[model samples]
Target chain A: MKVKAYITLKEGVLDPQGKAVEHALLSLGFQGVSGVRVGKYITFDIQVRSEAQARDQVEKMCQKLLANTTIESYQFEIIQS
Target chain B: MKFGVVIFPGSNCDRDCVHVAQTVSGNKVESLWHKETSLPRLDCLIIPGGFSYGDYLRPGAIAHFSPIMPEVKAFAERGGLVLGICNGFQILVETGLLPGALMRNVSLKFICDRVTLEIENNKLPFTCRYPAHSLVSMPIAHMEGNYFADSETLKRIEDNNQVVFRYHGDNPNGSLHSIAGVCNEKGNVLGMMPHPERVAETLLGGQDGRLLFESII
Candidate 1:
């Protein structure tokens, strides 16, 4: 099975890179851009038999290595296709 | 006394840290690679600054999961002294061994310059040589050096006297309370944004950073 994890800074945490991108877009004549927040998307190819097992393993991966729970949150979904 | 400096693949300041530790402390310092799962017995362990793992995903994000971190955790839990400087500070935060996070500089640029730091709490082993509130000049080189935490957590850290060093004169990175360094609850572990190793010698224009190493020894 394949899983994808979306990791992002928690709400209220400053995202300077995203803010810079927003500014650059506005500078280039793009308007109505209110805000931008950058995130990371990570995909994993794993060999798991059951949905429950996949969820457990993915959660463990996030907690142990994929994300820093102090400032960021991560969610993962198994891709059936 | 023996000292060990953990060297991640991308760690650039490991040599500077080793040099300072060896010179100032007169102790044998070993450079421990990130792949190693065990560390030799030592009085101190340093996580030096650098773009660890290329600072991908996040600063200190990938390096935090290195095989040696488990041993680092165990060493700290056993009351061993651990000091994380700059990128090392980020890794400590990622490892959940320290609170708060280091965000990008408010100026939106990588800052590399000398700044004054007021020693907030000299009670910890890392700063014991300095008098409380003493100002020391050191260089801070990083893009993600802004430190942030919620008000409640900040209050707790303040109450516990964990806030060790605060930027003086002017804040460089917009860190909350101008905090440049902090210690864990036990005070044996320290994580700070400034590079003490860089300013450890007078020939480097200042020796203010030497006291930090001298204190630990």
Candidate 2:
């Protein structure tokens, strides 16, 4: 099984990188862009017997390592192939 | 006093810390490897600076799981003195030993310069040598040193007098409350972004940082 995860800074947390990109975009004449936020995308393979088990495992991984609950939030999808 | 400095794979300041410890105390100073699961008996332990684990994902995120961290946590729990500087501070936060997180600088720049810091609380085992409300200059070098915490947590930390140092004149990284250093509730664990070890010697530029080492003695 393969899993894909998106990790993002929680709302109300300042995203300096995202803000910088937004400024660049506006300066480049791409207007009407708002609420820019930067995040991380990660993918990994896991060996599991069931989707439920994979979800549980990924949740633990996100909580312990992939995402710091204090500042970031994460969501993932388990892909069966 | 016996001192130990933990060396992670990418820790560049491990030797600097050892040098300070040896010079300050003239006592036994050991360099503990990150793979070791146990620690030798010591009066103080230092997690020095540098790009530990290549600062992958997040600074100190990977190194938090190093085999030595469990021992470090245990040592802190026992009220043994622990000092984490720069990257070491990030690891302490990731390990939950310290509150808050170090975010990217507001300007997103790597700041490396000597800055003035106000000693907020000189009563801890770490800052006891300094006079109350005294100011000192030390070098701070880091990209992710802006400290952030929720309102409630910040209030608790402030109410408990956990903030040990605050940027005096300039908020270099736009840290919340201008916090440059903080300690755990028990005041046994300290995490700060400045490199006091770098300025421990007179030839390094200043001797103000030596007072911190003297505080421990």
Candidate 3:
């Protein structure tokens, strides 16, 4: 099973890197582009028998280590490939 | 007081802390490797500054899962005094042993320089040598040293008098209200981004940093 986790800073939290990227984009002539919040994409393989089990395990990993719950939120997808 | 300094794979300031503890304060200090599962008896534990685990993912985010962190958490929960300096502070917050997270410097750059710090409260074992509201200069070297917490947690920490140090004159990192350091609710643990151990001797240009270690002693 392939699991992917997308981690992002929560709302109302300042994202300096994302802001910097947004500025660079504006400088490059991209217009009307806003809310450029940058996030992380992590992919890993799990040996779970079922997709549900893989999702459960990856969710646990995200909550425990992949993402900091205090300032970041995470969502994941389990792909049976 | 006897001290132990945790050494992660990428920790670069562990010796600086050991020097302050062993030579400056004349206390026994030991280096506890991250893979170790047990710690000897210690009065104080220091997580020194440096780019632990190369600051990957985020400062202290990866290092907190080291093999020794569980033991460190247990020790802190037992009320043992824990002092996290710089990268160490990041680890402490990541471990949930301290309130708030350290955000990137508002300038989005790695800042390294000497800056004045206001002693918000001197009642702590770490700051008892300085009079309250007094000022001291210390070196700060970090890209992510801005202290941030939700407004509610900020209010609680402020109401509980957990804030121990604030930036004086220059807010180098745009930390929340210029916060440089804070302690746990019980005041047994402290995490700060500045490197006090770096300026502990006159040879380093100032002895202000020595007082903090002496106070702990």
Candidate 4:
């Protein structure tokens, strides 16, 4: 199975990189853009027999390594390889 | 006082820390590798700054799980003095040795310059040499130096007087409450974003940072 994870800053956490991108877009005449936030997308192969097992393993990985928890939150999808 | 400086693969300031430790304490300093399973006798442990593990995923995220980290945790649990600077501060937070996380600077750029820091709680073992609210200039060089924590955690840290230093004048990295350095509840472990090792000698333009090392000695 292959698992994909999306890691992002928490709701109240400031995203300076995202803010800079937003400003650049505005300067380029891209309008109606707001609340632009940046995040990371990662994919990795996992050897698991079931979707439940993959989810469980991915959750632990996210908690331990993929996300800082204090500032970032993460979610993942388990896809058949 | 004996000192130990942990050298991660990408740690660039380990030598500077060792030099400062030896200069201030006039004692032998040991360099502990990230793969080492044991630590020699030491009174203070310094985690110097650099892009450990190339700051992959996040600063200090990957480096915190090195083989030597368990021993580092054990040493801190035994009430050993541990000081984390810059990238080291990021590692300490990742290891849960300290609170909060270091995020990207609000400027969205790497900042490397001297900024004034006010000694928030000089009573800490890390800052005992400085007087209350004294302002000292030190160089801060990092991209992910902004500190963040939930309101409840911030309140508890503030109430416990765990904040050891604060940025004076302008808020450089948008850290909450302008915090530049903080200590654990027990006040034995300290994590700060400034590079005290860089400014520890007069020949380097200032000796303000030497006071921190002197305090530990």
lDDT of each: 0.91, 0.95, 0.91, 0.93
The list of candidate 2 runs beyond 4 A from truth reads none
Which scores greater on DockQ, model 2 or model 3? 2
DockQ each:
0.61, 0.84, 0.66, 0.94
Give TM-score values for chain A, per-prediction. Answer: 0.88, 0.95, 0.94, 0.95
Task: Supply the global lDDT for candidate 2.
Answer: 0.95
Candidate 2 chain A has its poorest 10 consecutive residues by lDDT at: A66-75
CAPRI quality level assigned to candidate 3 from its DockQ score: medium
Runs in model 1 deviating more than 4 A are A27-31
Instruction: List pairs with backbone clashes in candidate 1.
Output: none
lDDT of 1 by residue, B1-217 (tens): 7789999989999999999999998878999999998888888999999999999978998998899999999999999999999999999988878888888898889999989999999988899999879999999999999999888889999999999999998999989999999889999899999999988888888889999999998
Q: Write the per-residue lDDT of candidate 4 for residues B99-182, one digit (tens) a residue.
A: 999999998889999999999999988899998999999999999999998999999999999989899999999999999988
Q: Give the higher-TM-score candidate: 2 or 3.
A: 2
For candidate 1, what is the recovered fraction of reference interface contacts? Answer: 0.69
- CA RMSD per model (angstroms): 1.8, 0.7, 1.1, 0.9
The parts of candidate 3 lying over 4 Å away from their true place are: none
Output the number of the TM-score-best candidate.
2
CA displacement after TM-score superposition, residue A20 of candidate 4 (Å): 1.7
How much does candidate 4 score in TM-score?
Answer: 0.98
Interface RMSD of 4: 0.6
